[model samples]
Target: MVKKSVRNKAISSVLGTVIVLAITIALGGLLYAYSQGMFSNLTQNTNINVQAKIIVNPSTNDSYLQLTLVNNGNLGINITKVTIDSNGISIPINVYLPPGQQYSNTFPLTSKMIAGETYTVTVYGNSNNKPVVETMNVLASTV
Candidate 1:
């Protein structure tokens, strides 16, 4: 009878340890999954795409600077200004673009554009109160 009681106590002790270990592993896995989702939601970013070109009118030979802005992020961006390197001029404008949307407009250039010349155009904007700037180099072409 003494030997049988000892054997039963040993079995119960082993079963209790197994149950605690299993519970610990399951809790650890659940915590890892929850933290992954929480951190991903906190780390979001804004992305803006910029494109520019010098468009020359075929009939009148007048050149104009065309700008195309695209918001490819999950946020909205407000365009505040644009600067052209060829003339060293900055134009102030107010334009708002939502996510997955595009804005395109042409501005008249005071100076004539020479074909095959490259120009640098810079765009300034804000998204979520953060300043954003995008610059692109484009060749002058007639259209």
Candidate 2:
């Protein structure tokens, strides 16, 4: 029988190892990039809480809309505008609130509100140079 040639065995083994190492490095890079984006988004989330109600004054039988805003995020936010959907009214405001702080105010309603009725209030603002909106459904009640 003719002798088997082994001259190319070492070269083949080296080539195969290089290909596997290249593939492993490429996969590792992709995994690292994906994880970086996920962590960044988690750290940059915004959280704002809103509470609203229609308050009726017992003494005068007058009605008003009350709003309470709480900033629970890591950045400060500015209250730029507010809208009462039922009355088709928009109120422009400029209020700055820092994290862990709150702001509350009451606005007189043009018309009286019926008790047990629901109303919609929308608040618009900016936080960290990004627009933010919070909508709340409020029920009319007497104090």
Q: Report every candidate's CA lDDT.
A: 0.84, 0.84
How would you encode candidate 1's per-residue C-alpha lDDT over 6-101 as one tens digit per residue?
433355778999999999999999889778764443566678888888887768878888888888877889999998787786878899999889
Worst 10 residues of 2 by lDDT: 37-46
Instruction: Please list all clashing residue pairs in model 2, or write none if there are none.
Output: none
> What is the Cα-based TM-score of model 1?
0.68
Model 1 lDDT at residue 49: 84
TM-score of each: 0.68, 0.65
Best by TM-score: 1
lDDT of 2 at 34: 74
TM-score of 2: 0.65
Candidate 2 C-alpha lDDT tens digits along 1-143: 99988665355778999999999999999889878764443465557899888888778878887888898886889999888789786878899988889999988877767778788889999988899999888888988
Clashes of 1: 0
lDDT of 2 at 106: 85
